[model samples]
Target: MTQYHFISGLPRAGSTLLSALLRQNPAVRAGIVSPVGSLVAAVLKDMGPDNETSLFLDEAQRAALLRGLFDSYYGALPPGTAVFDTNRGWTGRLDLLARLFPDCRVICCVRPVPWIIDSVERLIRRNVFEVSKIFGSDVGGTAYSRAELMMAPSGLIGFPLNAMKQAMHGDHSARLLLLPYDTLAEHPQETLAAVYEFCGLPPFKHDVDDIAFDAGEFDARLGTPGLHAVRPQARREVRETILPPDLWARWEGASVWRDPAFHRRVAVGGTPGADHGTAAG
Candidate 1:
């Protein structure tokens, strides 16, 4: 059986960053999203009058479509390597992933609700046009409201996140690791050590002794291609401006960010792997 680590979370909770870090380890092969599925769905749009794609595709065709998606992703990965895919709102389809890889370790990354909302708001302000260029008609005709997107019936971000939490509370806790974003921000090495253990990977030695994790501008040199490229300044703006002051209270009591040590890191530049959470969902 292949070992797979599923980085499941709401958008803007640092799934990209976490996936990038995990991918750096030689044992892991990260699977990022491709535009092929959406692209294919769009070209077939004219074929249907209403939302009747199901009528076009027979049972075998439907199965083939899903298979193409899986194959497109898995075919790129090296044999015997653990695969990691960091997609938001992936918890709802947990069983689907389980069937794909029987041995799976899920890392459900989470941030405070307020911060996540704020990040979504920022993404709406800046990235909508850029994202739409790729997703195009698949994203819907008119622009979507961030609030409505968050509370969508399909569980866009918040509710699905809560569902993940509930799963952790149930029988899945042994396989599901609830990693707070704040915890990672403060002590990346320590937190990542725990994650590596959970994923059954050998821990790498920590080189930086006095390093602090800062979500500020990352190293321009450590180019991990598309995964590491995120707008941290935009993230900070949303965290400071968009999220209401009231919401901070909910996370302020938590041990990671609320505690003095973590606060100190936030006040100063944090450690080696410091990451800024972006507004994306």
Candidate 2:
């Protein structure tokens, strides 16, 4: 049987890089975000009580159908391959995942909220000629306004952050492995070892110096080229904030995951004393 796992959490937080590193393992198959998570949600909606056809669908049927989605979508992979599906939505659907694949684990890539906004703004500036879909139809706005939109409850960065928070506090929190972008970039080999241990997978040497991954076409569609690109080297680049002083101050201490209490609840990369929880990252 094929073992399945997940890569989720905030945007621009090294998920693409993590996937790239993981892909180096011959037994593992991972990539940029996939459609399976959304497809699973669609399937559930159709089978839900709101649908007239749902009256005929029993629990067993629903379970089987949901399981089949993974089977079908990844059918092309060689049997026994470990599949790590990347999707920010998965963190919010842990209950469904627990039911469908109890052995599955979710790795949540995270960064300070301020930096997340800063990163998005940097991308917007880089693609000066292109108005990103990230801001929706109202792309004409100041950095402050764009930051507000991105921090709205349903906004790109906001939603994933909320979902990850919920997962961290939920019953299935142990199934999550929190991988901070800085930790992953600064100490990739050690980070990968923790990830392997969390997923119950045997260790495989990964090349951190020459990693490669990109989703240029996918990013272009969103008008944000290079959103999913990974650098050839996995190392942290220290830089000053591009955000204005006031903006930087506003979100400076917003990294709740850095709190000692939060660390006590979920496993954090490079933190040996962390809980280590009971499941995947």
Candidate 3:
């Protein structure tokens, strides 16, 4: 049987890198955001009261249909392969997932909110000639406006962050393993070992220094060329902030997972010591 797990959390965090590294394990299958989550959502919507034909369906039928989506999508994989479906929406759908795959776990990659914004800004600046679809149809906007847009409740960064926070405080929090971006970048080996342990899988040697991943076509469609690209080496690159000081200050301490109280509520990976002190920037 194929084991199913999930990868979710804030954008611009280390999900792309995590996926790249996980793929190094021959028994694992992972990649950039998959459409499976959205398909699951569509199936649920179609089975909801809003749909005229939904009244004919029972809980068992609905569950079977949902499970079939995964089986069909990954049917070609060998029976024992572990499939890590990447989607930010997964955090919010834990209730449904619990019913579908009780033993599955979600690995949420997170980072300081300010740095997330800065990373997106950096990408926008690097691709100056192309107006990113990240901003929708708006072709022009200042840094502040762009920040405000992304910080909206349903915006790219906002939705996943909110979903993660909700999951952290909810009943399914135990199924989540929060991995900080800084820790993964700075300590790839230790992070991967922890991830394997969390998933109950035996460890596999990974060539972290030669990690490779890119989603050029997907990124091109978004008008953001390198959105899902991962550098060959897995190491943190220190750089000065490109955001204005005031903008940086606005979001600097917004990483909720860094809070001591957060560790008390759920399991966290990559932090040093038993107390789970703040992760390095």
Best by TM-score: 3
What's the true lDDT of residue 91 in model 3? 92
| Model 2 stretches astray by more than 4 angstroms | 263-267, 270-281
TM-score for all predictions? 0.57, 0.93, 0.94
Model 3, residue 160: C-alpha shift (Å): 0.4
Indicate whether candidate 1 or candidate 3 has the larger TM-score: 3
List model 2 lDDT by residue over 105-156, tens digit each. 9999988777787788889989988979989856689889998888888988
lDDT of 3 at 119: 85
Candidate 3, 141-180: lDDT as tens digits: 9878898899889998889989988888889888889888
Clashing pairs in 1: 212-270, 212-271, 213-270, 213-271, 214-274, 215-275
The residue pairs that clash in candidate 3, if any, are none
Error of 1 at 137 (Å): 8.9
Q: Please report how far candidate 3 places residue 189 from its true position, in Å.
A: 1.1
Per-residue error at 265 for model 1, in Å?
Answer: 25
Best model per lDDT = 3
Clashing pairs in 2: 106-281, 107-281, 177-281
Query: Any idea what lDDT model 2 has?
Result: 0.85
**Better by lDDT, candidate 3 or 1:** 3
True-vs-predicted CA distance for residue 33, candidate 3, Å: 0.5
Model 1 worst lDDT window (10 residues): 218-227
